[model samples]
Target: MIVHLIDGTYEIFRQYYAPRPGHLDGDGREIGATRGVVQSVFTMLQDGATHLGVATDHVIESFRNNLWPTYKSSAGMDPLLLGQFGWLEDALRALGVAVWPMVDVEADDGLASAAAVAAADPRVEQVVICTPDKDLGQCVGGKVVQLDRRQDKLIDVDGVIEKFGVPAGSIPDWLALVGDTADGFPGLPGFGAKTAATLLARYGHLEDIPADAADWDVTVRGAAKLAATLVAQRENADLFKVIATVRTDAEVGTVDDWHWSGPTAAFPAWCERFGWPRLAQDAAALAAARS
Candidate 1:
């Protein structure tokens, strides 16, 4: 009844940098991150997750790059980690997990889209978006929630307000004002988290804020300077807001398609190739038990 959507891109990056032993295939290609992701997915399956889907960036550069020239790209990324992106997708598919290998759009878009679709399904009890990414917070509400597996935290609608000091709907506006360095957009000057949150808590959005600082009801420090910056960079802030917004139109297919049916026959061979022969047996045993 619960649908779990994973951020495969984040998992790969997390595992690659994690303090664990490195792994290489017979050809000496790095696959430590791929192996780690497979193990992580298996843990989720073993822990009673039935409906699952993973979203990965098939190409790191998405449409956001075209929107903002400085948006996040694959440049300077560790080749070892980058090389495993495709391999991770293949491994997950071989393990019988639904994989969304995003191309022009980023992985976050796929998660947002899938979360939206799953949340709309009447049969779904809850939709858990498994990522700590702030952008995903916009999708939090009703039956949908964000789960940070690493932090062991669940962020619901109220949790979004508690953490950001603004409601879930105001996340893009907040990010636009405060800036998101990860997404390669600098917001208006003199706007930090507290200032943005405080202002947004009252106005609810960018356009609604009064142009004059004197008209503002909030008590943020440097109100005049902040108001001046907002006036000067209002256009830029709107553009950044567009960049911060996650696209929910990705082709994630139906929620029924996301059910975990167990590993495929190719999974065993794929595991051996990755130098983890025991993973094949473990996966098969788990599949049989679940079946």
Candidate 2:
């Protein structure tokens, strides 16, 4: 009854830099990361993960780029690493795992959307969003949680509060004030984590905070300056919040559609083409045993 939503983009990046041998196909395409991800997913299946889905960044640039000129893009990324994204999607699909290749929206949005869909299903016991991205923290609550696979960490609602100093609902507001360098947005001036968390803890949201620091109940150092910065950049703060919020309207399918039936017939050919013939054998053996 538990549903696992993976961040394929993160996985590929992680594996690419990990201590491992490089792999190239007949045409000299780099595929070690892709192979590593396939192995990792198979390991997940072997370890009792049932319902699973993976979301990948089909294109690194999203609508957020149009909104902010400095939003993260794939400009400096290694061509070899970037080249494997589509192959990774194809490999996951061949493994019979549902893949959401996000283009207009990023992989994080797809995970958020899938997590929302899975959490709303009555038959689901839990929804695990498998990523360590701070943006995904907004989706953690109740039956839905975020998992850091690399660290074996599980973050629930309480975990979100413990880590971010605010509740899940306040994450966007918190990010807006504190800024997220990963997403390429500089938060309001004079508002660091402690200041943002403290103010947000008291006021709950950006719009709810009093215009004058003297009216605030909490005492923050440089409160007057922070208040002035917030007041001056109110419009920019709102825009930043919009950028921070993960869109749950992405077209991730329902829970039942995410179930892992087994690998497709194309899997063996894909493995051979990718120069991992052992993967073909392993996948077939696993599928046979499971069947």
Candidate 3:
């Protein structure tokens, strides 16, 4: 069986900004994002996805915030979207999808952990992490792959190299050197994507690179200045690497636990409350057809 792992946070963010009309519940709360995500997953089920899990950031702040003060947080986020995080998790659970509502850790870590667990199972044919997030690149290899639903791209180990210019294992190191604006870390001065990829392609990791540019075998523009900056800010680079690395140790359960049986008995009431009458019928029909 193929295991599908979704980044629920990204899906919510994407759907919030989608061109579709906004939806409001009877209480006048904005629920467009949550509805959109649930509908999308329902469609995935219609397309024959039997085993799946969604990882959501129950609280936007995670352990990374302690490491770097400027790491991404709920600050300045649309309160409408923030308010729906809990609703989304509840709706998915009612729909009978395995939902990982992460508390202290972010959704990315949960996805990485689930991907590792799913990939390790001998019965699993493939593990697909459905997200465009670059941080998930480190988890791509072997039976595990990443699917960017927006771009309709499936990324394997070779695809990671083609896109990042280095192997999948070096993505964290490359992100450390080039810096991730989304994650709020400034890499070593004078480092850009190409520069980091080239250096990392040679050295394979941040610590493996020589402190002196003169000791480096690869030719880069302004190698001496870049090397000096890296040496001076080695601690920060290491910290950034730590931040970039997606932890696979989260307790996301085994592959068998993610199997989709069918929507719960409460799902119809959930759809009625959301005014999505058609969703309940479609879900029931799909469940019956599969059975």
Candidate 4:
């Protein structure tokens, strides 16, 4: 069985900004993104996805914000997008799919946890984390992989190496040196992607790198200055690594818990609310066919 873990927050952001028609509820709240996400899930179900779960950030601010003052938050996000977070969770639940609405932790942590759990089960043939977030590279290996649904790309262990120039295990270390602008942490200066990847690919991790450039085994331009910067910002690098690492202990349930059993009785009402009654019929048909 293939287990699919979705980054619901990413999907919401993607759909919200997409240049498509807008939808509004009776209360004048924009809900087009939420509607698009539900339709996308239905499309996945039609394409034979089983035992899938979606992880959503119930709130944009998480424990990471407490750690780093500059971490991404909902401060400047569109109110339309923010308003649909709860609706997305509810819609997924109504679709009979397992939904993990994280409050303290971010959605990435939930995907990591679900991937870990699914990969550990021998019954699962593969665990596909459906997101393009580079932070998730650390979770790609063995039965666990990543799927960028928008691009229709499947990323395995080799894909991680080819893209990042380092192995999957060293992703957090790589991010620490290269810095993730999207995550709001500035990595050490003079360490671009190529430099960070070259060093990480050679030494394997931040701590493994030699303190002195003279002791380096590989040849890299500006090794002396890079080494000095690392030394000066060792504490920041360590903190960034901690922030980049995805937590695998979020409370997502077992593989069996994510199985699709069919929609709930409230599904029809939700479909009507979304002004897409055909979804209700399609869901019922799919359920009947599966049964």
Candidate 4 local distance difference test against the native: 0.93
User: What are the Cα lDDT values of the candidates?
Assistant: 0.93, 0.91, 0.92, 0.93
Q: Give me the runs in candidate 2 sitting further than 4 Å from their true place.
A: none
Better of 1 and 4 by TM-score: 4
- Which stretches of candidate 4 lie above 4 Å from their native place? none
Residues 171-269, model 4: lDDT tens digits:
999999988999898888999999999899999999999999999988899999999999999999999999999999999989999999799998888
Local accuracy of candidate 3 as per-residue lDDT tens digits, 107-182:
9999999998988899999999999999999999989999999999999999999999999999999999888999
RMSD of 4: 0.8
The worst-scoring run of ten residues by lDDT in candidate 1 lies at: 282-291
Q: Quote each prediction's TM-score.
A: 0.98, 0.97, 0.98, 0.99
Which regions of candidate 1 fall more than 4 Å away from where they truly are?
none
Indicate the TM-score of model 1.
Answer: 0.98
lDDT of 3 at 113: 96
What TM-score should be assigned to candidate 2?
Answer: 0.97
Query: Relative to the unseen true structure, what is the C-alpha lDDT of residue 191 in candidate 4, on a scale of 0 to 100?
Result: 95
Residue 44 in model 2: shift from native, Å? 0.8
**Tens-digit per-residue lDDT, 101-180, candidate 2:** 99999999999999989988999999999999999999999899999999999999999999989999999999999999
Locate the minimum summed-lDDT window of 10 residues in model 4. 21-30
